[model samples]
Target: MIPGVMEAAVLNKPMDIELKQVPVPGIKEDEALIRVHCIGVCGSDVHYYEHGRIGRYVVEKPIILGHELAGEVVQVGAGVTNVSVGDRVAVEPGVACGRCEYCKSGRYNLCPDVVFMATPPVDGAWAEYVAVRSDFLFQLPDGISFEQGALLEPLSVGMHAMIRGRVNPSDRLLVTGLGPIGLLAIQAAKIYGVTEIYATDIVPFRQDLAIEMGATAVINPAKEDLKERIAELTSGRGVTVIVESSGNGRAIPDALTTVNRGGRVVLVGMPAAKEIPVDINTIIDGEIDVYGLFRYANTYPSAIQALGRSDIDVERVITHKYALKDIQEAVEVARTEKETSIKVMIYPQL
Candidate 1:
């Protein structure tokens, strides 16, 4: 028996997340009603909570703000057949219009009509009950916890960046920024057979965590010369692949300098500055291939498979947990405590 109302953490505006009682969302014929179990606190979620916007997306009205989520199917619409009630699943928050050219070309993440969850106007999975399109939900194996299922979203981002960078066994990779995405990139690189992996971050905890997660070497950019360290690691040849997840203005140019000639640099981070000056000369002279990632496409299955394996312990990244009622505190800790926290998770059911 679905209740008429459910509890949710609603952002009335920036820094104003309220635990309110809202009507359970109704599902369309192709959608299912999920009882949200765990939701990961993404950097974008914190940005929106603190700043009320990210680039063009703004909180024009009240919205629920969480995208990385996992839940159990409580009910299904008449037309839903892929999953039934009681299925544990991870919800891919982006619902794309299948008719778009990007969708037809198998790059639905680029679909112009994508209604991404937690992106303004699209309510996300912060509530107790969320209506997700059946196609966007992936079943979780029994062994995978809800927390790990929620984390698959960020893992997918790392996987996508690695794919865009064309990571291979022979490639020496450099991952800038040891945020959740950067850490996951290290795991993804290892899975892809990249033996030599280097990571950099300003946070000592993150740098140490990166090393624990199989990074060959970790550098503290604030204290050390990053370019010199990369040069020393690569014997002055520079890394073959660079995954720039920091979005730090300085990291961008440094990556260009540290990447080998004809190397690939994949930009995964959303930079704080809209227009940072780039070294166009280096890009042109080195013939470097640069790729920009927007969310992810066709990566959930791979991410889930990777998590199923024992080699990569994705759960280790979770450093904090909070109930839905304390969402504001969770967001605050995630925003202020970067050095100590890797990932903060919210248990909506609690």
Candidate 2:
């Protein structure tokens, strides 16, 4: 039975999280109402919690802030048929306008009218229940847990990064970050049959997690010379592809020099500076292809299949968990505990 009112971790302003009772959302004919089981605190979520905005997305009012989520379908609109009530599913946060040119060409992630959750103005699934479009939901098989289901959002980012970089068995991959997205990128590269994966991060905890996530070697950029190590690792040939998941300004420029000629670079993380100095000569002379990944498009089904592999365990990155009522602490841990915590998960139903 669904209740008329449910508790939500509402962000009224920067650093203020309150548990307020809000009316359960009404679904459209093509929507489904999910009883949120778990939600993961994303970097953007933490950013909003701290500064009240990410670039152009400003938190102007009270809003629920969590997009990485999975749950059970408690109710469905009359037109919903793909998923029934009681189905366990992962929620894809971006709802695109299906008729846009980008959507028609299978690049829906670039849709101009996308309604991305936890992005300002769109109240997300930090609440006990959320209503979303039915088509954006993917059913989780028996083997996939709700935690893994919630992680599909970040996993899809990695999958899309690999896809954008055109990663393959023959390519050597250099991942410049060991955060949740970077760790998942290493796993995604492994799934693509790329055995030689080198990951870099300043955090020892994340570097160790990188190795655990299937990186061939982990490097601490602060202590070791990244380009020199890459040259040594590849015998001066350099890696065939680079996935830049660390928003650190220096990571991209250093990674560009380590990419082999005619190689690809996928930029997954948003750096602090809107524009950072990059080696244009290196990009031009090396003929490197640079692709900016903005969330994922058309990756849910395949990502779910990939997660079924016995070795692909995404939960390894989840270092912290909390109940929805403790959202302030959850976001605080995620915001301040960068060195210790990787992914902070929340159980709304708790």
Candidate 3:
């Protein structure tokens, strides 16, 4: 007995957001209708709001924006079997055509025909209800809160970076950002058995939060010599893995300087600049392997399992919450209040 219409926050243009009643989405044969409980505001969402695009994904028309979300399943189509009414779940935002080669090979994140939520031309979960493929929804464990469930999306990013970096128990890692992704990356590294982890950021609060999230040490890159500190911490050998989530142009060369020879540098952040100058000799001399990460592939189940465990506290990163009506302010705080806000969440039902 879902309503025919639901409230949604629509982005008509850059910096123009409006709340209006829109028709509830209809479920497909393999889709389920969910009543959204919580949605996390991501940097991508804010980027689209403020800049109207990210790279080439431009918003050509009115769109609903938000992707990191968790909710209760309220309706299902004929082919839906994985979730039922009242099941609390986290939504994996990317939907790939099963016939695609990337999908068949388990690399659906790179699928050419994939329709990812909030990435232009696809309406996302900033509304009261969303209809998503049943397989993309994972049931939340008994003790996991909706906020934590929504956070699985960013957690998946960190997990994907960890996998790409091939982080191990013996690896000493450097995470160059204190954003939500950086904080989650530190936690992911700890979960992967890396005992020595270092994090650097321009913001002190975020640096402190990183320490709380299990970093062995935190550095302020604006005031401190990051490469020298890493040298001191690693006893002049440098770290084995550098997880660059900041997308800062300067961080790239710093990573090349601080990473151990033959080590890996995983780039998770999307840089604003289209092209960055790189010293080919530096990369060649160290034989540093660089890896690029897009949104995660095949990580939803592992993210859910990690959330079910008690050791990792995903909720700690959340610093602010707002009702759907306050989405404008929410996005502003997330964009302007970086030092004080790590993760901002929205409650559509509120």
Candidate 4:
């Protein structure tokens, strides 16, 4: 018997995501049919809707608009075994080619042949049910909410950033953004034992939220001089590590200026323009370590481990929630980049 078709929010064009009835996605022999419960609205999804492009991936056809997902396994394929029906799970969206050199090097996130959800023509889990490979689904413990499960996708990036920075106890860490990613990085750094965390943001609410997230100090660059504040905070020596999550061109220069000699800087944000005037001379003179991120790898397990600990309450960063019916508004809210809105999620069933 044929299954029921469900309504999926498809990207029709720029500023347009229409609800279309798509056939229920089929499951492979090693796949499972999942009923999506929560899907986080990613920044890339908003970019694709507003500009119809993200880097070189052009939206030539209508595509679904979600990737960060938590769902229930409704049906398991004949060969599936990792998860059973009724298991709540978090879906890791990327399916990488195992034979790639990057994959063999344990850095599969850099795989050029990876097919990520919500990127261009790839349809994501923005509908009632999706067929996904069982290996990509991580079982959700009863103690964890589906929403938190959805958040792992982003939180893992933050965790990976901290790991990439090799954050140590009592290290002065400078985080130069207060978006959801930035906030999570704060929490990740806190858990990793960064003694004094300093945050910078133009948004007042974001700066306040940063303090709440365990920043020792919050600086508003719009109101304060970044270099002066860093110098004052560190007594002119500078921080040990910096995480540049703002994607603002100015933030890179400030990050370089704020770091101590031989400090590490990790860039997680994408700029409006890919080119940023990073003072290479300052980096060279300071002997700074700079790292670039492309999503994450081997970090989800740590994110799940953190969620189970109960020491860090990450859901506080969720400022708004939307149902599938309100997805258009959800994307629009994300685009506004308002201080009141940090991270937004779309619950298709709600």
Residues 135-166 of candidate 4: C-alpha lDDT, one tens digit per residue: 78899887999998999888888888998888
Alpha-carbon deviation at 85 in model 3, angstroms: 1.1
Q: Which parts of model 1 have CA positions greater than 4 angstroms off?
A: none
- Estimate, for each residue in 83-154, the C-alpha lDDT of model 1 and write its tens digit: 999999999999999998999998999999999999998888788999999999999998999988998899
Model 4 segments beyond 4 Å from truth? 1-3, 235-237
Per-residue lDDT of 159 in model 2: 92
Expressed as tens digits, the lDDT of each residue in 88-179 for candidate 2 is 99999999999989999999999999999999899998999999999999999998999999999999999999889889999999999888
Whole-model lDDT values for every prediction? 0.91, 0.92, 0.91, 0.86
Best by lDDT: 2
Using Cα atoms with residue i matched to residue i, what is each candidate's TM-score against the true structure?
A: 0.98, 0.98, 0.98, 0.96
Model 1 alpha-carbon miss at residue 293, Å: 0.9
Model 2, position 133: C-alpha lDDT score:
99
For candidate 1, report its TM-score: 0.98
RMSD of each: 1.1, 0.9, 1.0, 1.6
Model 3 alpha-carbon miss at residue 111, Å: 0.3
Screening candidate 4 with a backbone cut-off below 3 angstroms (N, C-alpha, C), the clashing residue pairs are none
Residue-wise C-alpha lDDT for candidate 3, range 1-350, written one tens digit per residue? 89999999999999998898999999899999999999999999999999999987999999999999999999999999899999999999999997888999998999999999999989988999999999999999899899889999999999999999999998999999889999999878877889999999988889888888889999888898888888888788779999999988878877876788899999987777878887778789989899999999988787777776667888889999999999999999999998799999999999
